[model samples]
Target: MAHASSTHDPNVYFVPHSSKWPFFGSIALFVMMIGVASWLNEASWGKPVFFVGVALTLAVLFMWFGDVIRESVRGNYNRQVDVSFRMGMVWFIFSEVMFFAAFFGALFYARQFALPWLAGEGDGAATHSLLWQGFSSGWPNNGPAAVGGAFQTIPAWGLPLLNTLILLTSGSTVTAAHHALKAGHRKQLLLWLGITVLLGCVFLFFQAEEYIHAYRELNLTLGSGIYGSTFFMLTGFHGLHVTLGTIMLAIIWLRCLKGHFDRDNHFAFEAVAWYWHFVDVVWLALFLFVYVL
Candidate 1:
C-alpha cells in the first residue's frame, strides 16, 4: 500500500506513509549478532544462522534501496528533499568518523599509556614490579606472556603502499567520473567510474593477499597480543568499508548506464562520491598511522 507517488508537486515534500524494511532489517541484525557470538564460541548451528541472516539483510537492503531509486526516478524528490538527503549523508559519514576514532584511540592508549604502565613507568613502577616483574615495555610487546608467541609485522612499504596508491588512484578516477557526469559526457563517465570500480577491486585483492601473507608467513593474527589485535582490527574494518564502497560504485555504474541521473539532479551520485572520498581519506590516515608510523 505504501508505494511511491507518480505525481510530483514542487511546493510539497514527499513522505512515504509506511515501510516494513526497517523492522525486517532489525530482525536480521539481531539474528546475525546472535549467530556471530555463537559461531565465535564454535556452536554447531551458528554458521548457517549467520549466513541466513546475512542473506536476509542483503535482501532487505536491496528492496529498500530499490524503493528509493524508484521514488527518485519518479520525480518524487524536490530541492528540499535533496538538501535533507545531503544532511543525512553528512551525519552518516560523521558517525563513521567516530567509529574509526574509537579504534585509533584504543591503539594510542595501548602504545602510550598501557604498555608503559605495565613496564613500571611513573607510579606504575610498584604495580609492574609486583605483577609483571621482568616484562619489557615495547611498542609491539605481546605482554609479559607473549600472548600468541613471536610474530613478524608486515613491512609498510609493500602491499600497504600498493593499496594506498590504488585507493588514491580510485579517488581521482571517481572525481573524473563526477566531472564527466556533470559535463554530460556519458561515455567518459562510464569509463572513469568503471576504472574506479576496478581500482577498488584491486585494492581489496591486495589486502586479502596481505592478510594471507601475514597469517601464513608473519604469524601476525588477531590473537597475537595488543599489537596484532589492533593491526587486524584497523585494517580489517577498513577493508570491509572498501568492499561496501566498491559495491556502491558498481551500483551507481549500473544506474548511470540506465540514465537515472542528469547534470542538475544527481544527488545519488554525489552521495556515493562523498562516501568514497571519505573512505579514501580514512585509508590515508590508516596508512600514515597504522602502517607507516
Candidate 2:
C-alpha cells in the first residue's frame, strides 16, 4: 500500500471535472434551512422533512468522501491531489478559527462592554444606575439584571479537569501513534492509535454527561443568561470539533487495519493527526478560559 507523496505520478492524475457535488450540497443545505424555518414556524412535518434532508446531505458527504478515499487507495491521487488536500485543510482550519473567534468576541463584548454598562461602570453610569439599580457585573446570574436568579456556577474541579487530562493524554497518544507509523512499528502504531481513539470517545461520553448534569441538575442552559450563552457556545463548538476529529481518527484506524498506509508515505494519517491535535489545543484553551477562569 503506497501512500501518496509529493512525487508527481501521471498515471494517477485526474482531469478537472464539472461535477454535481456542488448542486447536491446546495440542495441539502437549502432543504435543511427550510426545515429550520418550518420548525420555527411550528409546521407539523417540518422536522421530518428537515431530517430527511439531513440524511440526504449525510449520504452525499459519505459518497463524496468515499470517492476520494477510493481514489487514494486505488492510486489515482497524484501530488496535485495531495497539495489540494493540504490547502483545503489549511483553509478549513482557518474558517474554524474564525468561527470560534466570533464566539470569543461575543464573550468579550458581554464581559467588558455590555455587562459593565449595565452595571454603571462607565459614562453610561447615569443611564445604567437609573435602569438596573444594585446590579453588578458578574459571570452567572440566574436573576434579571436587577434581581437575577441565584444559580451556582459550575466548578472546574472534577469533570472538566478530568476531561482536560483525557484530551492531553489523547494528544500524546496520537503523537506516539504517528511516530510509530513513521518508524514502521505497525503493532505499536495500532495500539497507540486505538487508545487515542478510545480516549476521544470517552471524552465525548463524559462531555455529554456533563451537559446533561448542567441542564437537568443545575438548570444551566443557553437561556440561562450571558454565562450560559458563552459557556455553551465555546464548549459546544469544541465538542463538535472533538466529535469530527474522533471520526477522522476512526477512519485512519480503519485504513491502518486494512494496511492502506505505509510508513514512508502516510500524509492522510498525518493530516488527521494534525487536525486532532489542533482540536485538543483548542479544547485546552476552552477549558482554561471557559471553565477555570
Candidate 3:
C-alpha cells in the first residue's frame, strides 16, 4: 500500500504495476458487444444476455474507476501525468466531436441532397423529374414509395424547447460549480454541481416522456424513414452522452464529499466539467438541427 502511494520526484514519472482491471474490463466489453449483436439480430435470448453484459460492464467500470480514484487520492500521480491526462481528455473530446459531426452530416445530407434525389421536389415548379413519381421531396420524407408510412414530427416548441433550456441552465450551474471549486468553496461547489446533476436527470426524464409520446401518439419510430431514422439516431446518441456525463458528475460529487480535491488539484472535477459542457454544447446543436430546424 505504501508502495502504491509513492509520489516520486517531480521530474520522474510515476509508473504503475500490472493490474487485472484492463483484462476484466475487456472481457466485460466483449460480452456486451456480443449481446448487442445478438439483440440486433432479434435472438430470443438476446435481451437477457445483453442485460447481463451491461451489468458486467458497469461493475468493471465501477471497480476500475475506484482503483483510479484510490490511486489519485493516494498521491500517486504527478504534474507530467496530469498533463498527459489532460491531453488524452482533449483528444477524447475531439473524437467525440467528430462522432457527432458524422451524425449531423448524415442529417444534413438527408435533408439537402437525399431529399432532392428521391423522386422530385414540390418547392417551386419542380426541381427535378420524378424517378418514382408520387413521392414528393420534402423535409419529412419517408422513402421512395412512402414505404416508411405516415408519421408525425414532434413539435419544437414543447419538450425539446424545455430540454434546451434545461441543458443550458445545467451548463451554467456546472460553470458556477467550477468557479466555486477554484475559489475553495466546497459548499457552493456541491450545491451548484448537485443542481447540475439534477438538471441532467430532468432533461433525460423529459426526453423519455417525449419519446414515449412520439412512439405511442405520433407514430414516430426508428423505422419511420429518413426523417425518423436521422432524428432518433442523433437524439439517441446525445441522450447516451448525457447519461454518461451525468454519471461522471455524480462520481465527482461523491469525491467532493470525501474532500478529495483542493483548489489547485481537482482535475477529476475539471475533466467531468469539461465533459458536461461538451454535452451541453452538443445538445444545443442537436436541438437546432434535430428538433428546431
What overall lDDT goes with each candidate model? 0.88, 0.81, 0.84
Report the candidate with higher TM-score, 2 versus 3: 3
| Full candidate order by TM-score, most accurate first | 1, 3, 2
Taking the tens digit of each residue's C-alpha lDDT, what string does model 2 give over 150-256?
45567898899999999999999999999999898899999999999999999999999999998887878776778887888899879978988898888889888
Top-TM-score structure, candidate number: 1
Give the winner by lDDT: 1 or 3.
Answer: 1
Regions more than 4 Å wrong, model 2: 5-13, 33-50, 142-149
- What TM-score goes with each of the models? 0.95, 0.89, 0.92
Q: By lDDT, who's the top model here?
A: 1
Name the lDDT of candidate 2. Answer: 0.81
lDDT of 1: 0.88
